[model samples]
Target chain A: MTNQSSWFETAVADLVDPQDQRVWSIIVSLFGDMAQEPGAQISGGALTQIIEPMGIKPEAIRVALHRLRKDGWIESDRIGRVSRHVLSEFGRTQSAAVTPRIYARDSAPVEHWHLLIAEDGTGTQVLEDVMLSDDYIPIGRNIAMRAGAAPLQAEGLLALDISPQTAPKWIQDRLCPPELRASCRALLTAVQNAAKTHPEEWTPTPLQSATLRTLLVHRWRRVVLRQPDLPAAFYPPDWVGPACRNSIIRMLDLLPRPSAAILSGSG
Target chain B: MTNQSSWFETAVADLVDPQDQRVWSIIVSLFGDMAQEPGAQISGGALTQIIEPMGIKPEAIRVALHRLRKDGWIESDRIGRVSRHVLSEFGRTQSAAVTPRIYARDSAPVEHWHLLIAEDGTGTQVLEDVMLSDDYIPIGRNIAMRAGAAPLQAEGLLALDISPQTAPKWIQDRLCPPELRASCRALLTAVQNAAKTHPEEWTPTPLQSATLRTLLVHRWRRVVLRQPDLPAAFYPPDWVGPACRNSIIRMLDLLPRPSAAILSGSG
Candidate 1:
């Protein structure tokens, strides 16, 4: 049963070794006094109450119980609807010498990379969108070129929405900096600023820039990947040949921009 | 071999399953192709070359190769320095459709978190030290009256760095909120602002505001947790008591400023 789950969920399973160890430490620290009772069904609520002394994630107790059960060290059974978990003999043996150290995922904290948990508890943030900047463009183009695909084909591969025909004009005019005309990337700024104000509506502003088209094209990729493809009507009217958009994407990927830094503009 | 490597490295192993199916897609697709050529030695350069065509991590390639080997779908022989990984008949028979899809972890692009990675990738960010606010006295005094910790023990816990003999004045002056006293948390602002500017030299600018010591004594619980012992000098000269300080920390957590807005601040 465990192997099957591990096969499907390799990550959580893999973490069973380390994350499990930490989970066990917390569990044992709470129940050390109750160590002799083999089959005692400790209420999950009681587990949270135990950790009330420490300030951390509210759901960490539930997660600890779940991981414990997965590792065969604990067995949880429900009485009425209240879930109760108990340590197995193996768990008792394992928890003998653990010093209950806090296992935050940071090996060491660095100045540039902060591990932030939202104080608002909504853990949502902006790292969600895959950027379409000068830096990312060259990478998109080159990967496609290496895959023996032209610019448009590359865009499809990179999951960018832009077509090959219009891709070059977009890249040349906006994406690759130093060569970019300030007016070309104006649409991107407009889109980003607009996103801040209206969190839901995705349509571009009246500028009708490549960034807007790029988002639409990406949306189509999602549509294609999730819901099967639409018939050829998905193709544009008088669609030109050889994926013209790809050439532009290829040129963009050919750039040497560092992946992390933005090409221009401040937050 | 792949499983062994994965057991050691979570990021590499994570490239396998639901971390984002796109990662798995890349892994399986590239491995499937490479597995066909059993005699070819898969070098890091070759793997790098292949992934360059796709724009993913080298670790991802190693992980996929390991997974294939672990599942007995592939057999690998290491001769001198090169690893020759060959797919078994079962691998050929599995009719898996390898499409490009993002995995759970990689599903989100990582541009948003205000993570402070070292600029030179060396100096790490460690919290110099953490202490509760200046208003330790009044807060503890209030808790003292309520059904809180024992008066003696509570007093000790709140003492933090302050002495028991001088606790009351600190709490009354520095620790309590405006409704409790005449002042809001202005002293907190000054101390915190200084810490933010130079964490190494974190000293409260207003060290001698007559009531501050009383505030410190009262809020001792903020500086310390419940097990309170210490015969006296556990606190430094600037050591605010536990109760008031911990409360101040709690208050600070409430100010949820979103990481300087999604740092395209690479201007």
Candidate 2:
């Protein structure tokens, strides 16, 4: 909260790249919480409730879960209609080891992101950002805000930082092992790049490259104009040209500044 | 474009406050090149081409516009089947004036906000916040890169800046007067706050002083959570609580960062 602008900057940075690391983050968070509550099967509403604050749509969650299952990292161990993540033995070992790709912690997973979907109880799909960051803080707190989770949910982002609210049970029991954070970071960044290059496209195993990021940036520029805050001139060099500049600038001058926050984990 | 988090924050803000002003920001941007076209009238695909990037759910836009027309500020001057802004005496006054609310544009206007009805577009619907920062940068450019009226489009935001791009006559022509800017700031803030407090229940004139800002923040909080970089715990004090903290925080922690920048805008 204190270092908001910088925090905001990084949070936004994750968005500029392509990939779907954030979706994994949501999945990890889901499993983590599920692991903690004994006899507690994470219900449909519970998942929906948690994601409400985050911009992530419900549809995205289902897709991510399916993708995770396909990747062999997670499986469904269902008791009736309720769902529980069944991490494969390999998944468990990796959760402890921290693969250089997506970090898989069974507890205290981040679900700070949420999006509104026009789907069923599972919720509609949200943006699936699968990029990884080189740092855990970036992976944890920054992107969490983008999902709309409250500030409290994002505190876990800093490994060595003191959490005013997180309890001993959650932290001590759920830590993903700091060593594996690096691999997760790399994985996050890679997936992020891939998603950007293909906005309408989806791929669980993305290359996560710079080429993808440029395309994402281009996409964002388009977003600004459609938003109509300014004219073509205000838009980044990539999105506009002279003939139209005449009418666009008038709109840019009209918008006001914006503020946002994200909360996760049962809120 | 470089500041995606900020841009998204703005979008989140608008979504949260889907009142006339914020909603108009969403819609006018949807108007796309048409809104920026000075005298041009907008139609179907053109609207979609411009709007999809802004992420304005077409449904939301319809709801808001329907409500705006019911209120008053907007009425249509029918050239044919599709109506154009009669550009009311109020419309012309608003559109031509340095600032739109040249008269008593305050609580009274807000009270009458709902008066702007959807009746055949016969009257000028006071466009609260039509046009976005991004609207004119590209389409009207005839697809030109450097030569389109990019400068015109970027106006106050770009043209008047220290390093002005090549000036666009149109951009310069549309510059909002200084006084109007101040009024806009205040009006926008008031409208923004009201929209936040009132979400789906929004109207041009919300009787509840509880203000729409409250719900707007909550709804937007939903979107904020989607980012992977942000942790679930990283939310503002207003949103954190027994409600969303845990799930959001845990989820964010599990996600990856530097995901894809799926959408963006001047906001």
DockQ of 2: 0.01
Candidate 1 lDDT over A15-38, as tens digits, reads 122212344445654443333255
Regions of model 2 farther than 4 Å from truth: A1-22, A29-41, A99-267, B1-267
How do the residues A51-100 of candidate 2 rate in per-residue lDDT, one tens digit apiece?
43335578887887788778886766656665555556655555444321
Task: Give residue B211's error in model 1 in angstroms.
Answer: 99
Worst 10 residues of 1 chain B by lDDT: B112-121
Give all candidates' CA lDDT scores.
Answer: 0.31, 0.30
Docking class of 1: incorrect
Write candidate 1's Cα lDDT for B1-267 as tens digits. 443223223322212222233443443444433333333234444445434333456787678767777887766666676555545666645413221121011121111111111111111111111113221111211111121122222211211111122222232233332332211133344334423333232222121111122122212222222212221221234433333344444432322221111111111
TM-score of 2: 0.17
**Residue A262 lDDT in model 2?**
13
